[model samples]
Target: MASGPSDTRVLVVTTGGDAAGEESDVASSLSAHLPGQTVVRSSSTAAEYLRELGPTVDCVVAVGADADVVWTISETDPSIPLVVYGEEVLYTHVDAVIPSTASIDDLVARVQTEVSESRETNHLEEVNAKLTALSRYAKQITGCETVHDVCDRTVEATHDALDFDFCVLAFVEGDQIVPCCSTLPMDAERPIDLGEGVAGRTLETGEPQVVADMQSDPDATFKEREFRSVVSVPVGDRGVLQVVADEADAYDEQDVEFLEILAGYTNEALARLERETALRDERDRFHAFFEALPVPVAYVEAERSGEASVREINAAYERTFPQAADALGEDAADAFPTTGERRLVSDRLRDADPADQQIERSVREAGVEPFTVVLVPLERIGLSASGYLVYVPGTVPSDETRTGYSS
Candidate 1:
């Protein structure tokens, strides 16, 4: 990637009364040392030289040029290395300041070194820019909350930051690969299955597909025949990403590496979204089940002092135990008809080891039917509650009549 003499172009700007003689000497010496380089000589001030700047100009070698002009050029395009050949040593912005009386060999050597360094600096800057762009794209994809949003953003970011004529994000749905999002609209949405096109083949093998010239390769069966360069990267187990360009050898291993990083981000985001959705669904199902139960149920917790308290109660519990309707945050001992039963329940739960600990006992009150009560321990699940209390009507059942409560 190094720039040779043919690729180098030097803009020599001459200034002051003594500039004419010095500019000729400098230009002649540069031509003799670097024969193939294009050396353009111009006499102008800082403002005039700015207008003379062109795309082909690689480096600016100022001979007796005004100090202000040199500074202006350096500031304007810092990438363009500035070499000043003059007597006054300002040390402002030039990359190399050679004395007016310096030998031609010394001047040429300094210019050559500055040009090479400038080329290296420019290459590093380009690489840093790409890395910054990739980082920004990753952040954008992570912000998306849904699978569809992530897929869409992946296409947009890849197209904007990398070299590609078209891109696609397809997910595996059932036995077919479905197009979830793409950079361009298709005449007809074509679905690919296992062992079919590049995308499908990549998905089936769980590996990346890179085709240098899709038209010439028999294995390349992608719908788009115009694309010469193609890449398909699997997005975990969910899907695959495909990018295409019209020119031969448009992409290389480095391009594939970059796209793979993007694919990894997309997969992680999709997995996170799926997990969160599952949790939300499970929580809703549990809430509905608790609300619809016919029997009285209450969640009771044990404190460090060995006291039991009611943490939550269902609608049925509120109706059957009207006196303890406002039992939330209240001591279970106070909510119950008597203190003895609450203490007995807490001690039994504290001593139990299993998560689904259950005990049955008869209830005798001043009024109403003598109900059978059951307490279930919930310690194994890491909940704060010691267990839940359930009340079943009638006398305590025999072994054949009893049905164990499932945790």
Candidate 2:
């Protein structure tokens, strides 16, 4: 067992006759140099004292110890480093091979350095584990689709990765930041305003903020909520994600940085969801207008070859040409009465480029009345295809043409 950073234990073994005679002086020098440390001395030939104390000792000092004693120390515990004092010697287990003439200060410095290094190594391992958990959480949140899923995952992942007791993900709705997900129960009826608390301040400035001691800080109004420490990270311009701890000064700069990384992942996921929602709404509006149009209309998937297939036909199209409904999914050219009319329409609407706007072509379908068709490429309205919106307007050809679509 090794002592903690605050304290250390050093075991001194005197092997030869010369070392045994100077054991008291050597032990005193060691104790004086290492403050807040316990020093033990052993003179037994078999080094039984060293054996008994090896488990608890942090560092071992051999004063002119013979080969047998050194070998015993090495076999018992190779990890507990030995600082051999005497003429130049080499041992696999010995940490430092200093001459007998070397001062006590040299030995004290070596022991303290080794003990401090051991503690630091342990600390780094713990930090590495925490970072691994953070990475795993980032990967888990990528599959989330909805705003609710993003917010819930953000709060849950933070708790799982950092062990933060309380966490919340809020979104900017109108003039206020509203809590969408939280580890604790929230009052849905109440809204948290921007700039009201640490989280609010972070949202307003688009910066990460930390309140190390919420209860004791004069600037903090959130102390009424009873949290002692708080770290708030902004999620783009969208909102803020905050974590609260019960203990005062629980969070530091490292905690704030980790939360910032989490917020970055959350921001990207939320932006994608928002775009999808907007597109869905736009598609719904387009479907309503497509159904309500009074004119004979055929919405086709336009091709670079200027040939289009009728994806959907309105009621007016069915009334005008009842055969057109049964002819759904067929090329618009085949649905027309004459191949000449198909060539004419295709030529006028050339390549179905939305920038070319609307094109008109007149056609006489055998005995049927001659009518003018207006072809407007649906690509202008953000449809998937370089398609056209075909409608016969008032049975006449006109110079006036509509260029842009308004939603």
Candidate 3:
């Protein structure tokens, strides 16, 4: 079995030979080079010893012993590596079959290096899994439409993923942990004092802090002995976002680094969410204005041929022209033929002199109020129209002849 980084236990099974034989010497050398684990020599014969020492042995540092005996022992426990002293080695399962004459330091060094590399590979696989989870969280945070949504998700995701007993995300409002999101169930929200806690120190200095065992740690200020692990990672650029988690000695340097990376991406997403919210508010305000306008407004689309297409007409348009829907996107002149003493509105549209154009209308239908129609260029009304904002009868025509600079 592969042991931990600080330990490598090997069973030395040599022939019943001299005390100063290569196997006995290799056991002493292995003990000196490898830090932990005992290098023991089997007192029984190799055949008898192989049956006794099974999975407990990580490797077998074999010295000059019978090939039949060695092969008999090695085949029984293939997991245990065999580093031969001065024997022709023919085994596929051994990690490295070394000559027994090789220096003990070299063997120990190889074992230590392999053990460490395996641990690092495992840690990296764990990091990759964590990164995949954090990326999903990032997408959810940015998808939200409210600022509170961002804050709530940040605290919840951190708490659940890290297995922390307590978690509090605070915004840095000039040196205070303004409690924005937390997992304190059934408690009223309160701001944590910046100068009073470990989290506060990180915010004030813009550096991360972790107390592995809070009770024994000198830097830890909180007297709550139940909580052992404390980690504080700053979220924003230059300490603007703050995330602090408290567990039972679970948070390490690697965990802190992972949280910091999560925070950086979260900050950008929240910032964008804030801007979208503000823009939506502005659009809502315009909607209110569009509904309450005093004058009739028609959003008109102008064709290149100078024909007016009424895209939208307000409530006032229904009172002005009872047949407004039929008139929409239809030739304006065809809908209302020009009466005497009035120039054709279509003729003025063809000339493209929308601002100065005015036509008098007399409705033959009884009880109808005579009105004068004025056309202001639809483009000027924010609805680029060969179209015009036709006003009520009392409205005066704004000057169209005035010269102005075009942007």
Candidate 4:
């Protein structure tokens, strides 16, 4: 969507002096540079006038006659940015401070810049509003819990946010368009492998294609009578953001940009969701060790005897030693009821080489199963010494270790 208005109805306040003529002329000239019915609210005292006009005005162009006026206006509102239009200009307070005699081109450019910034701010607010609306749909997306959820949400949000008719989000599937999400007319199949769709072609080209009329255009692939316009915006350098609309020439530069922004949001959120999914998978796999094994599967760190304590131990350890969960972050001796077991492990760790050397040994502790630890130094594997892997007999099965070598 093209962002909200700027350079529109601006209340111009010429403060610190009674220069009505100067302020009016300046406001008139600046207002003329912009399009549409421009309203110029001229005043001598800006602080009082802005209070009167309130938030109905878009921006305030203040012509500060002296240095003191800049401070006064700046302190009073600061929300209505002051554009100094006098010989003696104060640089500190206003959004932009420039002398009135400065090049007309420069003045116009700054005004355009402010307009552009306002547009960006409006665009961001719109996106925020969309996200707020999408929060209610979180449960729907969350329930899906796959990449499919992300795709569905993307289409639903885009359709609602931008008021577009048909939205299609497709992922890469070799040479095909694997439809992940869509607000198409009817019940659409998931994982669309139709290689001939516009989405797939867009992904193959790695560029967005804007077709105003599919019926007239030979490049577009669709029931031309069904949709008049289409925009195939590529996502994350790979995926596709295919938007079809009923209006002829519906996809413009603005549409492309807005869809691109939506794609960017989808990419970021999907990446985060993917990472979270991976973490959950890792956690599930980590717990699976207790299914068939002898020793308790505990991840332990070889903490410095005096500097640190036991950082973490797994559920297997908690099962083997009923108190293992509560023992975390405590000194090994404090963690285990037996002092000899703690001394043996701590001493071995304290004297052990930094290299991840396998130390296979039988140990007996109170309320715990027989344990054999594979003291693999994690720092060698680019992982901080979170801990070592403890394989207790009947709790964790044994796996081969590459005797001693770093990649």
Which candidate ranks first by TM-score, i.e. highest? 1
Off by over 4 Å in 1: 1-58, 63-68, 85-89, 98-140, 159-165, 221-225, 252-254, 299-315, 323-407
- Model 1 agreement with the true structure over 1-407: per-residue lDDT tens digits: 23456777777776647557757777777777863564555654543544555445667777877766676667766667778887554756778888878887897888888777877787677657766787888888887898778987888878777645588888888888888888645752467775677877787798898988889877675545567888889999888888888787777777788889889989988888887788779757865786678977777777655577887788877776656566788887776654434654555555453222223332224346544566666543334447766666665553643333411
Of the candidates numbered 1 and 2, which has the greater lDDT value? 1
Instruction: Estimate candidate 3's RMSD in Å.
Output: 9.4
How many clashes show up per model? 0, 0, 2, 14
310-376 in candidate 2: lDDT tens per residue? Answer: 7787877776664667657777678655544355345544445432222333222533443455565
TM-score of 1: 0.66
Give a tens-digit lDDT track for model 3, residues 1-407: 44354555656665655745656777777777776675565535654555675555555666565566567666776645565555565643345555656677777766665455544665676678777777777788777667688777776667655444466666766656676777654252466566756666776677777766677766565444355667777766323333334455566677787778667666776778766677679747854664466655554455655555555666666555556566666555454434311233344443455443334443335344434455544223233334445545542444657221111
Give one digit per residue, the lDDT tens place, for model 4 in 288-402: 6533445554444543335335666655556666556776777666764543345434544443342222223323354334343444333322222344545434323434532
Total clashes in model 3, counting residue pairs 3 or more apart in sequence or in different chains: 2
Model 2 local distance difference test score: 0.68
Clashing pairs for predicted structure model 2, backbone only: none
Name the regions of candidate 4 deviating beyond 4 angstroms: 1-145, 172-175, 187-194, 278-283, 286-293, 300-333, 337-374, 377-385, 389-407
Q: Give the least accurate 10-residue stretch of model 3, judged by summed lDDT.
A: 337-346
Top candidate when judged by lDDT against the true structure: 1
Ranking, TM-score, top scorer first: 1, 2, 3, 4
